[model samples]
Target: MADIEVFVFAVEAELEAMDRERVGVHRRGRKPDLALRRRLVGLVWTLTFGGMQWRVAGWLSGIPFTTLHSAFARWARLGLWRRLGQRLALDWRLACGDEVLPSAVVVDSRSLRSAPSAWARGIDGGKLIKGVKALAVCDKHGSLLDLELYPANTDDRAGALPLLSRLAALGFQGDLLGDSGFKGAPFATAALAHDIHVSVSPGGTRDGCFLPSGIRWVVERLFAWLSRYRRLNIVYDRAPDLFAAHIWIAMISIISRRLVAQTHT
Candidate 1:
């Protein structure tokens, strides 16, 4: 069987369950094509693992580029990738003997240069890059919990509030650690209202030399993990939402591998 077929079979039950829930009473038109679904799922793996462009993946996978692109966008709109990431995160925590819900999380952002034609680009004064910024929140173990993308010139505090607010709505209550960019009375007050304590560490400098701090390093490492996926190393998608979906897909792949490894060991 093809690698995609094997993966689909492995997660067959989970996919079926999600399909049932997402499709709901609004069902119409013909039922989804299973063969096409397998191919699309395989294409996603190819994109995440090989960092192949859509056209390259289509040619390699023997699926039409237009079909693959349409399926991916439909799934992204249905929030399938985000749900998969969340489920895998819980599974990883369980495999590691930790609580499903994390007690604390680290937050950080990375600025990446966008394609010249990409929309919504901005300049990050700190990084000195003309592109966009990705703000992410990860648990203590570096599993991504949530992420948001905005123009690079957007203030760190401004970008962080929405993510923190989403976490709060999801019933998250814990301490949040971040770099100096997150320091401010306004941000702290906002976080406090969500029952999350906010702490900003001093710059990682000793005598003007750079060094890594302990707590905040987790989120930085999370960004490093994401960079391994070539597609995510830079912003190529014109739609910010599509870019965010790619982020979730990358995390889903990482966490799923770790979970499988833990089970065997």
Candidate 2:
């Protein structure tokens, strides 16, 4: 993985250029200096891979515990990370010569074990993990279009409802490919309600052998990529939105490196 500072610096120009468009509020505190802003943003990068303790991350990043914590939560509540991820994902796709809008998307979810302090968790009977569930919607190339996080106990079909609505809001109207876990009338009906077509992969193993299911497996690969971030390997965020924000941070980190590499090449 590349250093956090490198990714922060790489993204500085784009971040500066993108309109703040702050949602609801005339701020009280003065704006942060450029150096402080970089440190604050870099803390978000540290958050991507490190354990969820703000104090630990603060000490490691040479930032104050309360300062980093407040900034992170504020950014998440303000939807900065979400917009940043969306824009960067689009930039990456455009850089690679892909369309502005993806006609089809792959969706998948994984259960991660939550910490004792985690309040929002449920038992996923099949995975048997008592934690949160992450629903990642991605284009065929594995760039995340959007992400949803909730209790692990939520089944594939049921968990997909919010994801479908969010995708619909984002103007996605195409095939939603998934595993057989999502194959059923309920999910298909829900997806169709959003103008999305449901396409499920084959159910069960063939001769007890595992075979990758076409483009649906792209989301599986996306989970693999997310797993590399230590913090994401386990669920520790008190709020699902915070966990989702960290995920966006991780994704933007990945996109930053790719974009920077492309520039150098």
lDDT (CA) per prediction: 0.79, 0.80
> Stretches of candidate 1 above 4 Å error?
1-13, 24-29, 206-210
What's the lDDT for candidate 1?
0.79
Work out how many backbone clashes candidate 2 has: 0
Error of 2 at 84 (Å): 1.0
Candidate 1, position 245, lDDT: 81
lDDT of 2 by residue, 1-265 (tens): 3668666775565455543544532254655477877887877777677655788877877789888888778767877678777887888889989887788898888898998877587999977899888889999889898987878898878877888888998888999988877899988998899899998876348665545877777788888888888888887777878888889888888777788788888
lDDT of 1 by residue, 115-184 (tens): 8757678998867999999999988789898888899999989999888778987678998888888999
List TM-score per model, in order. Answer: 0.90, 0.90
Residue pairs in steric clash, candidate 2? Answer: none
As a whole number from 0 to 100, the lDDT of residue 64 in candidate 1 is 90
